[model samples]
Target: MEPIRAAIVGTGNIARIHADSLRGLGDGVRLVGAVDVDVDRLSAFCDRYDVPARHPDLTSLLEKEQPDLVHICTPPGTHHDLALACLEAGSNVLVEKPPALSLAEFDNLIEAERKHGAALATVFQHRFGTGAIRLRAMLDSGVLGRPLLAICHTTWFRNQAYFDVEWRGRWDTEGGGPTMGHGIHQMDLLCAILGDWTEVSAVARQQARRMDTEDLSMAHVSFAGGAAASVVNSMLSIREESYLRFDFERATVELTHLYGYGDDDWRITPAPEFADEVMGAWHSGASGVRSAHRAQFAEVLRSLRTGTPAPVTSTESRRTMQLVAGVYASAFTRSAVRPDELSTDSPFYRKMEGNGPRW
Candidate 1:
């Protein structure tokens, strides 16, 4: 098979990870081009990755190289426009998380994808890990029994200097604080495991950070499958941890890690009566792969080659983004927000702050 022609936009920290993952794919993919408005960063990234072509901007790159896949590593606010442009250019897009600044923007991207007949995927790399994959399989197969409760926590410390980057804390740019930017990964993973959420009641606080968005947000989400989850997204914690726990009828599964997790990070404690069965299934399940960009990129490339929708498709991403919006809406309005409540007319649908954060 011919290599998928791929290019990277936005030569920042995350872009390097994308470039490295693409390069690691060996012959299955080709880094044909790269683009960034900053000439120096673009040149340096291209030099480091041995990219054959470099453009001053995305439009020039798309017009010239016509890559089959475009990795969007730009800021949250720019994702909508860049992704639409890439899809219009007949390229599949793999946008970094918080796929768009708002639910409306995400829906617009969804429309663009359908209109262009090209795939649009978001970078929710957490779902690609073997551990997550195995856990999901077990749940689906009834080995884990019914999920009754879950705790999704993404607590990481980002100093005030971290928000000094101009786009880090604003609603119009970075979107919401930890809820939209930091915790969306865990939240997406939670959705992947538990399925659709029905309602959310949340509270957001500016707390310690001197930023426009909240430094911390907490929500209680009810799922359609009779499962409930407590989610906490915070940037003010001193000792950071990304922790998730799911209590099932047969077992209690827990994952404790900071940024990412491997097989070792997972732990299962089955009920005494079902311990043997749960252990047997857990021991025989998928293992070895860790959560990272490379795992997700491999799947993305495979989907592209097979003419299938890629992982974390826009539709799936919209669900996760909707949960994020739900948290914000519930917090700001001081009421429980349901899935049906957030349409184009909803304030949270357009901007995460929802008519400016009350906090």
Candidate 2:
């Protein structure tokens, strides 16, 4: 089979991960081209990745390579337009998280995908991890019993200097703070495991940061599956950790890791009566894969090969994005936000801040 041709836009820090992950796929995919507005960075990235073609912009790259996939590693502000360009050109897109500045922008890309017969996938790598896979399997098979309560936290530090960059902290640029940007990864995984969320009530604070968006956000989310969760996305923690605890009727499954997790990062404690069944199910779960760009990329390539939508499909990611918007809506409005309320007519759908961030 011919290897799928892939290209990347935005030669920044995260773009390197996309390049490396694509390269790591070896014979399954080819790094055919690259694009960046910055000449120096483009030159460096292409040279480092040994990309065969380099273009000044998306149009040129699409016209030249016509890559099977384009990874949008640009900032949240540019994700919508760039991914739209790829989808319009009949190229699949694997975009970085917070996929768009608003649900409005994301739905635009979704519409373009339908119109163009292309796929739009968000880079929610955490969902592809072995532990997450195992847990979901058990949940589906009733091995884990009913999911009752949960906690998802992304607590990592970002000092004031981190937001000093021109686009780092603005609503129009980076969207909201930790909730939409940093913590969305874990939140995506949470959604993956718990299924669709129904409502969110939350609070956000600019806290210690001087940015226009919140530095800390806390939300209580209710899932349609009769499960409720407490979520915390913060850039204010000194001791960083990404922790999620899912308390099922039969067991409590906890995942503790910083950025990614190996199987060892997960721990399960089963109720005494269901001990054997829960332990057996957990032991038979997915293994040997860490949650990373590579793990998710492998699945993405497999889907493309099979002529199917990729792992983190537009629908799934949009639901997760809506959850992010829900957090912001609940915070800014001082009211609970539900999935149905975030429509095209809703201000929160057009901008995460709704009217504006209260802070």
Candidate 3:
């Protein structure tokens, strides 16, 4: 099979991971080209990754290499236009998460993708991790039974220096606070595992940070199956202990990672009655950041070749974005908001209006 050709935009920290995945995969992928606004940094990234081709911007990159797919690793704010441009140019796109600043912008991107008949995927690669896989299997096999409750705690410290980047702390650029930024992966996985959420009520604050956006937030969500959940997201905590727990009628399943998503280091404690089943289902759910990212890349290749859909599609990503908007809406209204109630006319869905967070 021919290796899929890929070009990556944005040479920031995360892009290096994508580039390295392409490099380490050895034969499954081809690092065709790269694009970034910073010439020096772009050059350095290409040299480091051994990618021979580079473009100054998306336009030239599309016109030049015309890669089969473009990975939009740029900031969240840049996703809408970049994804549209690539799709219009007849290229598939795999954009990093928090797909767009607003739900409307995401709709625009989706429309463009459909009109152009292009493949569009969002990078929620944490869904492909070994731990995630095992958890999903348990949920599917009824070993955990119907979940009664769940909790996702994503607490990581981010100092002022971390948001020193011009676009880092702003709502117009980076989108939202810890909830949308740091906690999104776990939130996405929560929704992925437990099914859709019906309503959300949240409270947020800028406590302990100079950023204009909320550095801390707590949201209570109700899933379709009447399973309730609480998600606590923060960048103000002194110590970070990330965890996701699901309480099922038959058993309780818990997954914890020290830093965040894609961490294989996990622990699942089943209820005493279901202990045997849990033990029988146990597999080494070992993984690292690289492994999850690589699995998604390979899936992208399979989708391109077989015309099969990517595991994480744009619509699924939009639902995750809707959850993000719901968090903001719930915070602003001081009440619970249905996830689907945040439509095009909702205040939270208005793009380019919210002030970006400040350091």
TM-score of 1: 0.99
Model 2 Cα shift for residue 144 (angstroms): 1.1
Question: Model 1 clash pairs?
Answer: none
TM-score of each: 0.99, 0.99, 0.93
Q: Write one digit per residue (lDDT tens) for candidate 2, span 1-359.
A: 99999999999999999988888888989999989999999999999989989899999999989999999988888998999999999999999988899989988998999999999999999988899999999999998889999999999999999999999989999988999889999999999999999999999998898989999999999999999999999999999999999999999999999999999999999999999999988887789999999999999999999998898999999889999999999999899988999998899999999999876
**Candidate 2 lDDT score at position 144:** 82
Candidate 1 contains a number of clashing pairs equal to 0
What are the root-mean-square deviations of the candidates from the true structure over C-alphas? Answer: 0.7, 0.8, 2.6
User: 62-128, model 3: which lDDT tens digit per residue?
Assistant: 9989888899998887988999999999899998887788888888888998899888898887788
List ranges where model 1 is wrong by over 4 Å: none
Model 3 misplaced regions, further than 4 Å: 259-264, 284-291, 352-359
Q: Encode model 1's per-residue lDDT on 1-359: one tens digit a residue.
A: 88999999999999999988888889989999998999999999999999999899899999999999999998888999999999998899999988998999999989889999999999999998989998999999998889999999999999999988889999989988999999999999999999999999999999998989999999999999999999999998999999999999999999999888999999999999999999998999988889999999999999998898999888899999999999999999999999999999998889988888787
Candidate achieving the largest lDDT? 1
Ranked candidates, highest lDDT first? 1, 2, 3
**How far out, in Å, is residue 41 in model 1?**
0.9
